[model samples]
Target: MKHNWTTTKLIAVGAFGVLRVLIWLPFVAINISTSSPLLLIFSFFFFSLISVFSLLTIRQFGTVTIQTFVEWVLELPLPSIAFMPLLFAAAIIRALVVDLLFFFLRTKEAAASIVCGGANSLVLSALTYVVYLVMGIPGTQTIPSAIFTPIGLLLASTVVFDLGSTGGYTGYLVYKKMANTAVMRRIQGAQ
Candidate 1:
């Protein structure tokens, strides 16, 4: 899709991107402090939902804009400096996966949202593991040897896929409600 990056659209992307970071930062901080798996999973859901919402709002290059903004935000903090490269790559990969899926699926319908969300989550998780292995991060071996097995991979994939799709569905519902409002229409230039 050849989208013209008008000033209005650039401003919209910047606005929505800031919104995404504002909403995501607290969750990330909490998850980092607590090291809770449940919080991590919830964060993924929120992340996907927000990304999808931005995509639906912008109607083009939404994921890319938000992901770039997110990486830029992370880069500013000293604590995240070490992980910036990996995080940036993962964010870009996830954005590409979602955008490409949207392109191939050719619709912003619930099903496409679900697939995009699921695929994005799955790719991120896979990349995390790859980074762990390549970087030889501590505690890599204790990830349970079974998880390397085919059955384990399948089970893990299934759970992640379900969580992501559920998130996507939730995002779609939220977008629908928001999109119906006059404020959202004005922001989207649909008015």
Candidate 2:
């Protein structure tokens, strides 16, 4: 696909990227402050909403390349490369999943958003688990723990993704309305 990265589009993408991180920071802090699975789950529900909203905004204003760039910028402050591979993989998978679904299903409804979001999260979570295993970071150590079960983690991630995507779909409709209204007002004013 040919990308038309005009200054306006780039700025919009970058601003949206920063907005994504800003929206997520508070939730991340909350997650860090508590190890409660229930809390995390609840927070994930909200995070999914915010994440999806960000995804929708990005998609509305830019392309997958811009989305991926935003993801990279979000991860730039990480202490190690532990999450880089997973993030990059997520970006590619998200784009492909959305594109393929868009092609076959030929719809941009809530279903598409939910499927794309959950698929992206699941792929990333699964990849992270595999990478963690291969790197031997918590291989034998945490495998015995209840929280470390692969299936549970994957399911949680998937649920979060689904919720977030649904939220994004809802948010897109709202944002588009507001945007259209603003544009109409500006046009009317010029006449």
Candidate 3:
């Protein structure tokens, strides 16, 4: 089965954008409206940053830009949506950083590139998380959230790494081997 990602990719991006809104909707409607800095950051700002950064990275490395852009537009109408101006601003910054890493930093190996991408993403996430704390959000929950950011980064990194790794190559090689050979022989034929 070929991965004709044009339509499938669009659908996936849309679903994830909706998921982003769903995850934050409750936080905005219930908790973050009170103007607490921490609340605002967690429930709204930081998450939007993460979403934009993630989508931008995908667009850069994969052929998913148009789909990502559409989903991002859809997200703007969300009740807790952060201001559009800021989102674009962050997107621009994220894009530049990604370009720097992809062009200036990465070597030929997919694993190294993925690791670099992962590190950059984690740093951005951490910066967003810290911004939340600086706004006076309670560390009780926010603190733990920060701790998990690196782990999330690691997970994303591995997912991308597996995309073109030796393991992935090995799997295809095995499949090819099975398909390329067809034998029907009886071991007792000589008896």
Candidate 4:
């Protein structure tokens, strides 16, 4: 089906994009200022949450069009050219996992949300390491830092799981409730 441009869709896209930024900006700022990965746990969780939010918002309010993706990219404060590959890769992974859960598996629940969120975290994190490798970023890891890095990352993974599952499950439930309410109202109106 052809999706015509409409004001509501434009608004929804813009709104969600801003919301995603609002949710992420503070943590990102902190991470930048401190130059510390200490907050990486919360950052990943928030990032994954917004990533899932982007997918759900797009699915509900906009067409799966290049324009939609472009709008999202334009709305956010992307870091740099070096980050684009990871960003795009994360988006693709999230989209694929979400599509698989909702379209093919017919899962619109917590499990699906958690899975999508976890996949987003895993893909983004793994890609980040790859970028570091390419850039020759040295790991300043002493033995303790090395030991803690994986532990920290693992803990961050749980954040991804919790937030993703909660957001996905709640968002789907709310959407269903609203849809059902609309249907019921229509039926009543016809009566």
Candidate 5:
């Protein structure tokens, strides 16, 4: 089906984009200050929640990806220039994973959300490490160096995957609830 880029849809996308950034700012500050991987558990949860919610609500293929790019633009001046590239890549890859999964799976079920969230988190987390390694940025351990080993990688990946899956499942529940509301019905009808 061909989707129209109506003014209302554009406005909704921009609003959700800003909401994603707002949800991320505190997590970014906490992660930078503490260098704690644990914080990412919450971050990915909300990140996946917002992404899934936007996709389900808008029923648009690029909704999450576009919102993420908007987020990247808004966040450009917040972090150091060195970290911007990693952030840019993460945003694109995460959103793409979610979008592609939804597209291919051809269903907005909870299982799809779970997979999208887990895969999105895992891919971006690995990408961060790879980018850091390639750039050789000193004094930056995206996760603890001790966790760079095979066992550590496995454990960390499992934790993040669970965190993201939980987030996505919760997002699906929230979307389901919101979908039943009059406001959501009207908004969706307008689209």
Candidate 6:
């Protein structure tokens, strides 16, 4: 198969970035304040394992994380297993998003992966800033979460990519490019 080297790379990096956020931040956030090693360890493993779904979702659909579908999921009064997993589903969508972007950009998967990772960092950091600003100061839940979230994401990304892959080089460039990709897709299509 004549692989789209550029697009594939981009997809990999981008997915890897989103993967960073979904898989890492929460565990870091939890570990920072709490002393429960068991809890921390479990959180780390669980989030890391969640990475599979992110890839699975992309393998199935060519869409980004269905934030809208997720919004619907929130409406349901499901228990932890049902609703919580749905929330983590964003990681998978994030991966799919990078793939979709690579497809449309007509680039190599490597570049897509790079773009995706960069996008994730920028978005993650900016999002962290925005939420903090919007809330004016950040309470207990928000305070620890804000500081640890990006850190957690970065940590998770680095760990998953032990060989020092995408997260090492292109992690910072992502958010700046977020505006760059706005022209290509509508972000959300229909319902």
Residue pairs with clashing backbones, model 2: 48-164
Query: Which scores greater on TM-score, model 1 or model 5?
Result: 5
Off by over 4 Å in 5: 1-3, 79-83, 136-139
Indicate whether candidate 4 or candidate 5 has the larger TM-score: 5
lDDT of 6 by residue, 31-73 (tens): 4447322233333233222222232223323333443244324
Choose 1 or 2, whichever is better by lDDT: 1
TM-score of each: 0.80, 0.58, 0.39, 0.59, 0.84, 0.35
Provide the lDDT at 40 for model 3.
Answer: 33
Per-residue error (Å), model 5, residue 131: 2.4
Count of backbone clashes for each model?
0, 1, 1, 0, 0, 29
Could you tell which candidate, 1 or 2, scores higher by TM-score?
A: 1
Instruction: Output the lDDT of residue 35, model 3.
Output: 43
Across 71-170, the per-residue lDDT of candidate 1 in tens digits comes to 4664476454234567667667777878888767647478877887787678767776676567765444556778679999899888878887787778
Judging by lDDT, tell me the better candidate of 4 and 5: 5
Give the winner by lDDT: 2 or 4.
Answer: 4
- Each model's lDDT: 0.67, 0.49, 0.42, 0.50, 0.73, 0.38
lDDT of 3 by residue, 4-96 (tens): 334444554565456655665666565555543334333333233333333322333432233235545766766544545545444445445
User: For candidate 4, lDDT tens digit of each residue in 81-109?
Assistant: 32356556655554455455544433354
- 136-188 per-residue lDDT for model 2 (tens digits): 54222433355458986666666666664565465555555654464333322
Ranking by lDDT: 5, 1, 4, 2, 3, 6
- Give candidate 1's error at residue 89 in angstroms: 2.1
Worst 10 residues of 1 by lDDT: 34-43
Tens digit of per-residue lDDT, candidate 5, span 125-145: 777656656776443555577
Question: Which residue runs of candidate 3 sit more than 4 Å off their true CA positions?
Answer: 1-5, 37-68, 95-191
